[model samples]
Target chain A: MAVVVMGDVVQLLQRQPGEEGPISDALLLAALANGDGNALAELYLRHHLKVYRFLARMAPLDQSHLDDMVQNTFLAVRQGAHRFKGNASVQSWLLAVAANILKQHIRKESRRRAIAAALTEIPLETTTDETPEARLARQNSMRLLGKRLHGMSHKLKTVFIMCDLEGISGSEVAAVLNLRQGTVWRRLHDARKQLRVALAEYMEVDT
Target chain B: MTRCPGKEQLTRAISNDSSAELDAHLMECPVCRDECEKTRKLIEMAKGLPDGHPTSQTVTRIADELRATRPERDLWASARPGYGVVLVAFLLVGAAVFAWNYVFYPPSGPSGSANTNAERRDSPKGNVTASRSAIYTHSIEHKGYAFDEVVSLREGTVTIQVTPLKSNERFMVKTDDATVEVRGTVFTVVATNGRLVKVSVKSGKVHVRPKHADVAILTAGGQWRRRTHPIQKPTAVLPHSPDSGVFPIASPEAASHLTKKTDRLDRTDKTVPAPMKKKETVFQEGWSLLRKKRYAEAANVFDNAVSSSNGKDLNEEIYFWRAAAHYKSNQSEKTGEALTDFMRRYPQSPRMDEARMMYGWHLFNTGRYETAKQEFESVRQSPLPHVRQNAGLGLRRIEARQ
Candidate 1:
């Protein structure tokens, strides 16, 4: 066999005959569980962006922290691959693990007693379509919302973020959080009420 | 408006859990209707939050870490030399260990009362505790390593008191249930009846993972539990003191010095006068050769030392090194004979306990489980914690094998 390095293989990127389209996330994870390095690379390429965005929203983390969390979530997937029972979608499972990792990190840093406000400096301009004034309004609302979340308990904030903001269904939130659906709805309601009181000035005065 | 359906039910209604009473209130009361519309708008506003994504550094780091942690079996198999080479290497390590014990502490005959003091001076007297209820505390403080902490891993239902230390060090304590990691913290771990491992931190923090449970980082006043039959939810508790103490031992500093000396001796310049014919010089040359891993040359040097009349005075030490060199040269029978002779002639030797422990391991490796068990039991009462721990692990390994 000839010696081959990572760069030399890039020129041979064409798919071999009969190799089907993009593999399903679950199947790629299953192959990863079998220690297939290629499957791991493919899986990371597919889900790293979605996971990174989720982690950034999940905690008040810097760029390094966001990068580490994404890497940790995938590394965790590799370690716990055999334990992936497939009860939730692989992406949902990854997000839940990322959330738990944040919780542990917060707990270790002695900030569990109080949420570190704006733990994130979320850059607000994600779309070019919105006018500058409109983007500023959204940024202020999010910044105010982040502060309001800091005052709320972890449970209520997680339920609110997943259900009202991320748009995950209440039942799915229950599965991700190991809580009852009624409990999820109740927390979401509590979170929403707190935000209403905290952001009434912004609410009464439109952007 | 008769107090609208309680806050709980109103909250429930936001998720569309419409009770008849709430629906009637919304229909009849304009105030309640306006509140519901405002609440709905609040959720919509939150949903409009901008997306956040990370840079490509995350992907590259993940790939590199995955590659680094790949299983070592493939590399191990591919790196092997021929069968002859492996047999020779194993013999070398076994003999080297044996020679290390003998040369480091030469034997003392029955009347050598003066020699007993030398042995006593080398004995490591750090700390020892009675394993009452199968739970006890052991303090580990190594200034050389990042270890100036005391952590305990207890099996069975026993309460141990651990005192806080004033240093920056980390250490790991393990039992059947979990491994507890401590870094300059005071904590206690208890395993109840060999079925569970429980860790409670009084100050600082500790990382613990039960064999089949989640990794938990426990802060001061936090407790973690892993059980064969888990029932109670793992949670935090207020910190409390049971009992704690400190025992000062200077072994860590001495060990650091020993390591530095060994490194110096092991380096070879390969320019020495031909093997010294004088008996004393022969032993010195043999020791130097062994340090360099020149096993065959060392074996010949030690053999020459033993044959000379002066060798009689240091036969126990010479025999130990001779056995080591033979083992290193893959001469198993000669190695066994040398060890047996040393054991019989110097029963009161300072290294008798260590020899027995090594012989037990040799027996265990050669499938003589019964003899190995006996050898391990003989040294089960060794005062050294490290030796006792090794013996305990060895016993458990045998039982597991069976």
Candidate 2:
């Protein structure tokens, strides 16, 4: 843990244990809570891509408010750093925060529909050049994926994304979501069922 | 007696979270085992999905946002009432007490400072009277300010004197409609008409702002009048003003010229009973009213003068005075039009630079940004140092916004 003195901030007390050579993620977070700018810069370098990936997967074509969502998530990290329990890994905690921010964002039903519709209309920007047939197939699959993913309830969506996409174990997700492992497994099952049906329909249309 | 293992049991086994019972159930049923294999493949596809990343601009923006919110952290921590709260509360109470004492118990004499009373003191006898013509005099000290306002509240040509203790101190003799703000000065503010206050700065400068009107500064040897009531009856002069020789309403110099002409009229036309003013006389009267700050009355006179002088020279003075009257009345559109006409008609006027700055400021205030920038830019190249400095500052302000 490292301490930084700031005006009106009496003292910074380290909570997370420190390490040698390279700072652990938990130690970096503790330093950030203590107002360490260097710790924040390092954490940003490590986690910005993962946070952005989470947002883009959720709201694919909503480029307009994606920056705001990402910024708000990190802002919460700085403000709520003292409350970080470090029970789960820091990556799981960051994903949890990003998910919570996203939940609050799509709480408005109209905005959720608008973003989903927009995502369906615009093809994802592929890294390589895309042929007409490949582009259409890619766009159709992406639309079905986005629709099927968000169509699940937030509980199932969180469990599904954490377990399947991010490679977080069901136990880690259960810890992050404050749920039992059995409940996390049940939600993950429901999400997989809905997604399989959507994928079956999508594959049939393609054939 | 067991049925097929469900999709949930298949998910449990595929994600490696299987209990002994779930594994046995999945292994015993062929359909449940096949479902578990498809679920594993779906999870594998999700793990191999292409990543979507943020641009570098976005990362910097998030860091900047966190930095901006850093200031709110201290406030959030101390939002509750704590140790320093008592000291802050005590200081506020002390400030309130000091304010109360300063307003009601202002000191007497030159050490006293002025506070804006809730209601205007009608006569000096409401508090302090120094024997000569209901005089209201006080000394007040506030925030280390000391001053005296010797206000004579009697009728008929009573001169008021003020002694300002500091350079920034203000003393005023307030009337019903106008507040006469002065520093160390000697001035006479007469109730010229039932609804007008005539301020004659005998020795020093005074700033007089009428009720709901902008301030107008008058220097020594300058004379101006403002209306004391909203409903003013257009009268020539105060009835109580006995010394008509120095009366500002109709200047003695102007009267002399009119008298010399009247003498000629009497010689030429003996039957003329009423000395009716010619159109030239009417225009001169409007110009005289404008110089005296009787703008509403002057505007009417200027309008008549402009209509009559259409066939004649329509002197440059008419345009300038008309614009001045319009500006004082807060008619910005008319003022803009009039000033534009004046600048075109009299490009070589001595007051052109100051007038250009006025027009630019007017344009800026009205949100005509591009035209205002052009105006300020052209004025920034003026030979006059002060004008150039002012225009340069204006351009900088506009540029900062841009």
Give the per-residue lDDT digits (tens) of candidate 2, residues B336-390. 9877977988787644664576566567657777888888887777765655766
Kindly report which residue stretches of model 2 are placed more than 4 angstroms away from their true locations once superposed.
A1-19, A108-110, A122-139, A203-207, B1-9, B19-28, B44-51, B64-71, B74-402
Residues B1-402 of candidate 1 have per-residue lDDT tens digits of 656766656666665766787888888887777778787788776655554565566567677676556632333334557865888999999998767544544333234343333443343122223346666455544443234333354465433333332233235666655667655456666665443456667777777756655567778888765422111211111011011111111121222232222211110111233443465466666656765767778888777666666456664556666665655554556656666777887787655655565565556656788888888898899765545655665677678788
Interface RMSD, all candidates in order, equals: 4.4, 3.2
Query: Candidate 2, TM-score vs. the true structure?
Result: 0.41
Pairs of residues clashing in candidate 2: B112-B139, B112-B140, B112-B147, B113-B140
| Local error of candidate 2 at residue B5 (angstroms) | 5.0
TM-score (chain B only), all candidates:
0.30, 0.29
Q: How far is candidate 1 from the true structure (C-alpha RMSD, Å)?
A: 37.7
TM-score of 1: 0.37
For all predicted structures, in order, the TM-scores are: 0.37, 0.41
